[model samples]
Structures are given as C-alpha cells and as structure tokens.
Target: MELITNPQPLQWPTLLKRPIFDNAEIQQRVMPILQEVAKRGDEAIRHYTQLFDKVTLNAFQVSEEEMAEAQRLVPETLQQAIAQAKRNIELFHTAQYDAEKQIETMPDVICWRKSVGIEKVGLYIPGGTAPLFSTVLMLGVPAQIAGCQEIILCTPADQYGKVNPAILFTAHLVGIQKIYKIGGAQAIAAMAYGTATIPKVHKIFGPGNQYVTAAKQLVSQTGTAIDMPAGPSEVLIIADHTANAKFVAADLLSQAEHGTDSQVILLTTHAPLANAVNAEIARQLETLPRKSIAEKALENSKIIVLPDTETAMAMSNVYAPEHLILAVEDPDALGEKVINAGSVFLGHYTPESAGDYASGTNHTLPTNGYAKAYSGVSLDSFVRKITFQHISKQGLKNIGLTISTMAEAEQLRAHAAAVYVRLEE
Candidate 1:
C-alpha cells in the first residue's frame, strides 16, 4: 500500500479519481456479451461458461443427490460453524419481519402500507478461491424472513462441473433447493431473462466482480431490480496511535485477498503507526494463500497519515466504505459520528471478517462509493411496500376537497372529476 502524508481534504471526485475503468471501457467490453445473452439464452450461457470458466456441463442444475452428498462431504467442524452463524442471522433478521401498519391520514381518509415479498428473487453466490458458504446465511435468512417464495440461486461450478460441498450444504441449511451451476455475466442474464431451466426473477442480490457488476447494470437497464450497485469488496480503516499494527495489517490483507480489484485504505492519525502497519502488511501478506490477488489489491490501497481524527473521519465519510473498521481508543464514539457505511466494526477485537461470515450482519453491501445513496441488503430489500387507502363517508368528506383542490391546481381535470364522481356516488 502507498503511503501519502500531509494530504489535502479530498472530495468524492478526487477519491474516485484513482485509476479504474472509465465508462468507455465498460461499454466497449460488456455490451456485446450482454446483447448476445439477451438474444441466445441457455446456449449463450453454455458458450461463455466454457470459455471463461473452462468448464463444460451436460446440465446446469445441482441435483438433490449432489446437495446431499455435498453435506456428507463437508467437514463436521465447518458445519457446526455454519449452524451457529445461521442461528444468529435468523435471530437478527427475523426481527425485521414486520406487520403492516395502518394510519388514519384523515377522519375519512384511512391510509396504510403493507410489505409484500418480491416473488422469485435470484441470489448469486461467488464460489471461486473462497467458498463463501457464509454468504448463504446472510442472504437466505432475510429472504426467508421476508417470506420470499421461489428463491433461486446461481454460482459458477468448478472445472469438474461441481461446486464446493460446503456451498451446497449451506443452501440446504437455509431451505433452498433449486441451485444452478452457472456464474458470471451469463448467470445474471439467465436470471434476468429466464432460460429453459433457470427461472427469471424480479431482483438479484450478491457481491461479485466487475463482469458480474456490469451484468447487473444490464439487468436493471432491461427492467429487472437489483439489490444495489454492488461491486468488489472495499474497506476503510480509521486508526490511531492506540491501534495495533499487526491487527490492522491482518484486516487490510483479509479484504485484499478477496480479489485483485478489491480496495483497502487506512487513514490514521499517527505516522509511526502507519509505518509499522506497512511493515506488518509485508510480513503477513507473505504467508497468505491468495497473496498474488491480495498484492494487486494492496497496490490500490492507500495509507494516509492525517494530522487529526476529524480529518481522518471526513475522508472515511467521503469514501463510504462497505466495511468501516475503527481501530481507535473509542470506536463506538467514532462509529456514532459516521453518517454512512454498510457495516461498522469497532475496536481492536472487532474484525471485518466477523461481520462477513458469522456476525449475523448482511455482507452484501454497496460498493464503488454507492453507500452515499444505496444500502446493504436486508429483509426490506426482498419486499415492496404497497400503500392502501380506504375512503369511508367521513374520510371522503375530510380528504376529498384537499385532493380535488390540488388536482385542479395542476390542471389534472380528470383527476378532480374522478373525486367529484366519487362524491356524487
């Protein structure tokens, strides 16, 4: 990670100015693949899966037998971990299951809102270098809580036309049966367009790479709702002299190992601590299994030594990191001042991975600086709020004039006429 000291207060444009793709590259590279998928369907899926993943499959579905065998093959210790995570996830999200609220807007104008689950939602689980079975709980528990029916899942199978046994095992743990062994742009296309086997859904959720992010953008353009403008993982750590360099380095490397495109940043008040962190990052990264991928991400990471905590916090708010870890003396106080973030990890004992895996918080979050507007997935993401009104005689008498008067001012004569007609009736 490059260390920059005595920096100017940065703006969003300046923060985003770090060289990534411009729209031109995105349009040029991703448009054709999306177009092809839109036209060809499953054949396109087969073609791309073979080309990119180097896997050919006779069929795409993970059979019932395979799911059972996956369960059997998984290590017992990991299964116990998954079970514990599931319980906590269920406990938190289950509370988010709320009943419809009815409010009397006026004496006669009774207004209320009810949430209904978005039927046939699609979930994409990344199954490459890391078998992220924990993501299953983060997604599945909320979908279940929101009472979503027909939750379909897709992930890229390995070269052997198979997925990690743990991934399959986690799926079963959450009561999902329909699993597709597909991934990338093609998988998003199948979920958005509907194939001979893969059913189309109204909304898709999960974090993925640039191609997958591009695919989701295309899906939304074609009239499908997505959870958020999710991209590869990113984190911002606001640390102080009190922070442990070893722990800070470990946290940075954890997110870095996610992918080559993942970003990590450390904004600290102390210069010596930053130097110590840089040294520890080198030592820790040398032993990581995904060191090369982490190295590319580290190249993009920034360690900025700010003169004060206020300046460091300002930089973090501008970035709106998906995961914000406060390695300070009083993280709870620091966290309170935070306006936006997907998830917050406080103090030395709290690591971002705890939230990522078993901490019961949704790991699917806004990326590419989208936390400024978008939110991480929750039970609410799976449901739509529908407003209802009941106009009894008293309600009509009280609210009719207000509605008609507003309508007439806008010159919506027909709207006023409809209310007038209601009055007459």
Candidate 2:
C-alpha cells in the first residue's frame, strides 16, 4: 500500500480526490435493457440471462425441486451457521417493529402514525467471485419481519444455471419463495420493470457491482424507490502502534477481497506500524485464493501515517468509509469521534467478518462515500411509515381559523373554503 506522512489539515474536498464514473455512459448502457424488460418482460429477461450468464435455464424462478436439491447439496455445518445467523438477524429486525401512536394535537384534532410494509420487494443477491449467502439473511430477514406480501429473490447463476446452494438454503430459511436465476444489471432491470416471472416491486434492496448500482439508479430515477446508493465495498481502518499488525492487515484484506473496485485504506499514528501492516498484508496475501482480486483493489488504496487520533478521525470522516475499524489505544474514544461511517468495528477482537455474518448487524451497507448520508439496511428498509390524521368537529373549530387565515394569505381559495366549509358544517 502507498504511504503518506505529515498530511496537512483534513479538508473534506481535498482529503481524497475520488474518481467519478460517467453517468451518461452508464445511463446509455442501462436504458435499453430497462426499456426491453419493461416492454417484452420475460422474453427480454431470458435473452439477457442466456447472453450474460451463459446458461439456458428453463425459466427465471427457481422451482421447489431446485430449492430442495440446493438444500441437499449444502454441507450441514454451513447450514447450521446460516441458521444461527438467521436467528440473530431475525431477533434484531423483529425488535425494530414499530407500533402505531395516536396523539391529540388540538382540542378535537387527533393525529396518528402507523408503519406498513411495502406490498412487494425485490432482493438482488450477487453471485460473483464470492457467493453472498449472508446477503440473503441481511435482506430476507428484514423483508420477512416487515411482512412484505410478495418477496422476489434474484441472483446471477453459475455456469450450470444454478444459484449457490447456500443462497437457496438461506432464501428458504427466511420465507422467500420466489427465486430467480438471473444476475447483473439485467436482473435489476427485470425486477424494476417486472418481467413475467419477476414481480414489479415497490422497492429494491441489496448491494452490487458498479453495473448493478448504475441500473438501480436508472430505475429509481424513473420512479421506483431504492434502498440507497449501494456500490462497491470499501473499508477505512484507523490503527495505532498498539494495534495488532496482523489483525489490521487481515481487516484490510477482508474488504479488498470483495471486488476489484473495492478499496481499503489504513490510517495510523505511527509510521513504523504502517510499514509493519504493509509487510503483514504482503505475507497474508500469498495464501489467499482471491489474491488477484484483492491485489487489484489495493492499487486504489492508501495507508496514511497521520500525526494523531484527531487527525486520523477527521480524515476518516472525509472518506465516509462503508466500514470503519478503530484499532487504537482507546477504541471507545475513537468511536465517539466517528461522525461518518456505515458500520464500525472496535478493538482488535471485533473482526469485520463477525458483523458481516453472525455479529447481528446488517452487512449490506452504503459504499463509495455514501456513508456520508446513507445508513446500512435495517428493518426500516422494508417498511414505510404512513402518517394518519383525524379531526373532530371541536378540534377543527379550534384550528380552522388559523388554517383559514394561512390559506387565504397563500391565495389558495379552495384550501381556505375547505376549512370554512368544514367549520360551518
């Protein structure tokens, strides 16, 4: 990793000059697929599935037999782990269940708010170099907890036109029945526009590569609500001399292995520690099977040796990393200073993998600086809170004059008359 020392004051815009993709180019690439799916439905979906996935599947949706076979194919130990993770995820999401609250604003004016799950939702699970079985838990559990009526699951299939066994197993474990053998931007298009097999969803959720992210933006712009701008995975670690070099190196590599576009940065107080981490990363990179991918990602990453924790934390906020790790002397103090981060790992013991899997936190998070504004997926992702209001005659009478005067000043005669009519009636 490239190392920088004595970096000047942290200026948000000057911290890191992030590269921006060509939005026009992305839209041009995604528009036709979206239009085709919107027009031809299943026919467009199947063609793209064949062209992109290199498999001739019978149809998009996975059958009961296919799911059963996938379950049988997975190892028992993996199944047990998935089950345990499912419980943790379910417990966390179920606790997020919100109840309706009624309140009186004025004499007879009663107001209330209630949350209702979206009628339909689409989950896009990426089956790339790594099959994201955990994503099924991350997305599927919240969808189930929110009580979405129709849940559609889509994933890119392997060369043999089948999803990862673990993907199928997790889907079933979370109560999602409809699974599709599709992948990439086309699958996103299929779900957004609704093919014969894939249902049109009120909202779409999950993270993916740049292509998939572009497609999500395309569809959402036209009207569909997306969870957030989720792009490639990235991590920022703030470590000091006391931090275990091995642990810091391992955390950086964990995110690096995610994809070629994924970026990982290490910010430290001591210069020697940065060197130690780089050496440790080189050593650890040798045995990993995904070394090629991780190595490519490291090309875009950097290790900055700052002067102090305050400088490191200030720079970290500028990065707005999808995942932030504090491997400092007092990690709790570091956590308190964090203002921009999608998720956090404190101390040497809290590995990113723990939260990615069994740690009871959602793994699908905002990336590419979106951590500045977006939050990781939670129960709120699957449901929408619709505000409700009721006005008793006495209440309207109390508040109507104010409304009438305001509406009259705004020159909205109809609005003023509506209040007057109500008051008179």
Candidate 3:
C-alpha cells in the first residue's frame, strides 16, 4: 500500500477517488441483452445462458428434487451454521418491525403509516469466483420478515450447469421455493421483464459484476425498482496505536480479496502502526487463497498518516466508505461524529466480516461513495411505507379554511372547491 503523510485537504479528493470505469460502455453492451429478453422472453434467456454461462439448460426453474439433492450435498455443520446465522438475522431484522400508531395531528384528525411488502421480489446471487451463500441469508431473512407475497432467486449455474449447494440450502431455509438457474445481465432482464418461466418482480436485489450492475440500471429505467446502485466491495479502516496491527491487516485483506477492483484504505494518527499493519498485511497475504486478487486490490488501496483523529475522520466522511471500521481507543465517542457510512464496525473486537456473515446486519450495502445518499439494505428496503389519513366533519372544519386559503393563493380553484364542497357537506 502507498504511504502518504499529512496531505493537504485539497488533495484528499484526488487521493480518495475510487477506480474509474467506462459505465457507458458497459450499459451499451447490456442494452441489447435486455432488448432480446423483452422481445423473445425465454428463448432469449436460453441463448444468453448458453453464450455467457456456457451451459445449455432444458429447464430454468430448480425442481423439488434438485432442492432435496442440494440440501443433502451441504455439510451438516454448514447447515447448522446457516441456521444460527438465520436466527440472528431474523432477530435483528424482526426488531425493525414497526407497529402502526395513529397520531392526532389535529382534533378529530388521525394519521398513520403502514409498511406493505412488495408483492414480488427477485434476488440475484453471483456464482462466478465466489458463491456468496451468506448473501442468501442477508436478503432472504429481511424479505420474509417484510412478508413479501412472492420471492424468487436467480443464480448463475457453474460450467457443469448446477447452482451452488449452499445457496440452494440457504434459500430453502428461508422458504423461497422459486429458484432459477440463470445468471449475469440476462438474470436481471428475466426478473425485470418476465420470461415464460421466470416471473417479473417489483424490485431486484443483490450485487454482481459490472455487466449485472449495468443490467439492473437499465431495467430500473424501464420502471423496475432496484435496491441501490452498487459497485465493487470496499472498506475503510481508521486505526491508531491502540489497534492491533495483525487484526487490522486481516480486516483490510478480507475486503481486498473480494475482487481486483476492490479497494481498502487506512487512516492513522501513528505512523508506526501504519507500517506495522502493512508488514502484517504482507505476511498474511502469503497464506490467502485469493492472494492475487487481494494483491491487485491493494495496488488501488493506500495508508494515509494523518495529523490527528479529527482530520482522519473528516477525510473518511468525505470518502463515505461502504464499510467503516473505527479501530480507535474510544470507538463510541468517534462514532457520534460519523455522518456518512453504510455500516460501521466499532472497537477492536468488531470486524466487518461479522456483519457480512452471521451478525444481524445486512451485508448488501451502497458502494462507490453512494453511502453519502444510500443506506444498506434492511427490512425497510423490502417494504414500502404507505401513509393514511382520516378526517372527521369537525376536523375538516378546523383545517378547511387553511387548505382553501392556500389553494386560492396558488390559483387552484378546483383544489379550493374540493375543500369547500366537503365543508358544505
């Protein structure tokens, strides 16, 4: 990692910029796939599956027999682990459920908001370099908690034309039965515009490669809702002398291993700790299976030596990382100043991996500086909050004049007359 010492605030933006890409080119490539899916439906899906995934499939949906075989294929220990993670996820997301409470904004006027789940939703699981079975729990638990009427899953099949066993097991665990053997931009298109076998969804959720991301963006333009704009995974760690160098190195490498485009940053008050962490990263990198991927990601990453914690934090807020780790002496105190970040890991013991896997928080988060505006997926992501209001005769009389007067001032005669008619009734 490159080491820079106390750079000027003006230079922070250049130093912190994420690796750039030609999104227009990716969208240009993805558009034809979407158009084909819309025009030809299942035939388009089959053609793309053969072209991209290199598999010819007779059927797209996973049958009961395939689900049973997948269950048996997953190790018993993994099943237990998945179950434990599911419970924790359920516990955290279930607590987010809000009971409807009516409020009297004025006398005899009652108003309240209720959460209604999107009737149909689709989840895409990437099965290229990594299977990301943990994501199944992240998305499925919340969708179930939100009471979505119909839930379907799409994952790319391997060269041998089989979905990941762990993915299927986890989906079955969450009560999702509609599993499809589809992948990439074609999967997004199938969900966005219904094929003969794959039903269209109200919203599409999950992270994928550049093509998949582009496909989601294209579909969203045509009226399908997507979770958020996402990119390569990233993490930022703010550490000082108090942080363990080995642990910090491991955390940084964890995200770095995600992909070549992934970036990790370190902001520190102590220069010695920065060196120590780099040394630890080099040592740990040798043992990792994805060391090549991590090494490439580290090329895009760096360690910055700041004058103090305040300056480090200010830089972090500007970067607005998808994952932020406060590895300082007083994490809680520093946490109060955090205005931007998709998810935060506080103190020495807490690691970003915990949230990615078993810990209750959803791992599907906003990336590429989007944390400034977007939030990580939660129960609310799966449900829409619909607000309702009721007004009695006396309540209309109390508020009618204010409404009519505002309408009249705006030259909206019909709006004023609607209030006047209610008043007369």
Highest lDDT model number: 3
Candidate 2's displacement at residue 298, Å, is: 1.1
| Candidate 2 TM-score over all chains jointly | 0.96
Question: What TM-score, computed on C-alpha atoms, does each candidate reach?
Answer: 0.96, 0.96, 0.97
| lDDT tens digits, residue span 1-425, model 3 | 99999999999999998874788998999999999999999999999999998999999998899999999999999999999999999999999999999999999889999999999999988887799999899999999999999999999998888899999999999999999999999999999999889999999999887888889989999999999877689999999889999999999999999989898999999999988999999999999999999999999999999988889999999999999999999999999989889999999999999999998999999888989999988999999999999999999998889899999999999999998998887
Candidate 2 stretches with Cα past 4 Å from truth are 9-24
The sequence of per-residue lDDT tens digits that candidate 1 reaches over residues 1-425 is 78888687644346434335664577567777777777888888899999989999889999988998998999999899999999988887778877777788777667888888898899989876677778888888898888799999999999999999988999999999899999887888889989898999999988777888888887798799999877888888999989999999999999999988889999999899988999999999889989999999988888888888888888888788888999999888888889878888999999999988887888899988788899899989999988888888767877889889999999999999988987897
lDDT of 2 at 158: 88
Best by TM-score: 3
After superposing candidate 3 on the true structure, give the runs of residues whose Cα lies further than 4 Å from its correct spot: none
lDDT tens digits by residue: candidate 2, 192-303: 8886677788899999887788899889988888998788888889988789999999999999998888889999998899889999999999989999999998988888
lDDT of each: 0.86, 0.87, 0.93
TM-score of 3: 0.97
Q: After superposition, how far is residue 245 of candidate 3 from its true place, in Å?
A: 1.1
Candidate 2 residue pairs in backbone clash: 108-395
Q: Which stretches of candidate 1 lie over 4 Å from their true place?
A: 10-19
Model 1, CA-based lDDT: 0.86
- Give the CA lDDT, 0 to 100, for residue 409 in model 2: 94
